[model samples]
Target: MRNFLIDSLGLAGFGAMNYGLYLKFGLADALISAGGLLLLLALAGARAAKRRNESKGAA
Candidate 1:
């Protein structure tokens, strides 16, 4: 699962960001949107890690 996240989602995200920088040049809104996406990803990763730890204690 971790490998999937790093190999697929992470690669796609950086790929998009790289393309976004070229396509959406000089636009502050684009940067804001990128930041928002990164924030959401961070929140999701935290939630997943939390669940993993929670399940470990239950086991």
Candidate 2:
């Protein structure tokens, strides 16, 4: 479901950032991972919002 995707993607993104930091990866690399995660989260939110709008329109 949508919830599962959001949760898993968010956690994976955070984990990637943390792992990068722990391994002494540079800021640029960390930022890249973080940006990717942000994009995923944004897309998920948009999908949920669109579904909500459609449901309301149907009612």
Candidate 3:
């Protein structure tokens, strides 16, 4: 399914980001990267929620 592929790609991207950050910089930088990842997830969740609400209201 399209959603499965999207989710898989997102997971891969997160894994790559974490791996690269830790490998290149170490723990401290990796923590920063984690915060950034959390922020990104929060923003994405908010966007998804908004779209769902909009769609529900339109229907």
Candidate that scores best on TM-score:
3
Give the Cα lDDT of each candidate: 0.81, 0.84, 0.93
Q: Write the per-residue lDDT of candidate 1 for residues 28-58, one digit (tens) a residue.
A: 7667767787799899999999999999999
Candidate 2, residue 46: how far the Cα is off, in Å: 0.6
What's every prediction's RMSD, in angstroms? 3.4, 4.3, 1.7
List the pairs of residues colliding in candidate 1. Answer: none
Please write out the lDDT profile of model 3 over residues 1-59, one tens digit for every residue. 99999999988998888889999999899989888988999999999999999999999
lDDT: worst 10-residue window of model 1? 22-31
Candidate 3 Cα errors over 4 Å, as ranges: none
Best by lDDT: 3
Ordered by lDDT, highest first, the candidates read 3, 2, 1
Q: Candidate 2: which stretches are off by over 4 Å?
A: 1-23
- Cα lDDT, model 1, residue 47: 100
> Model 2 — TM-score against the truth?
0.62
What TM-score fits each model?
Answer: 0.65, 0.62, 0.73
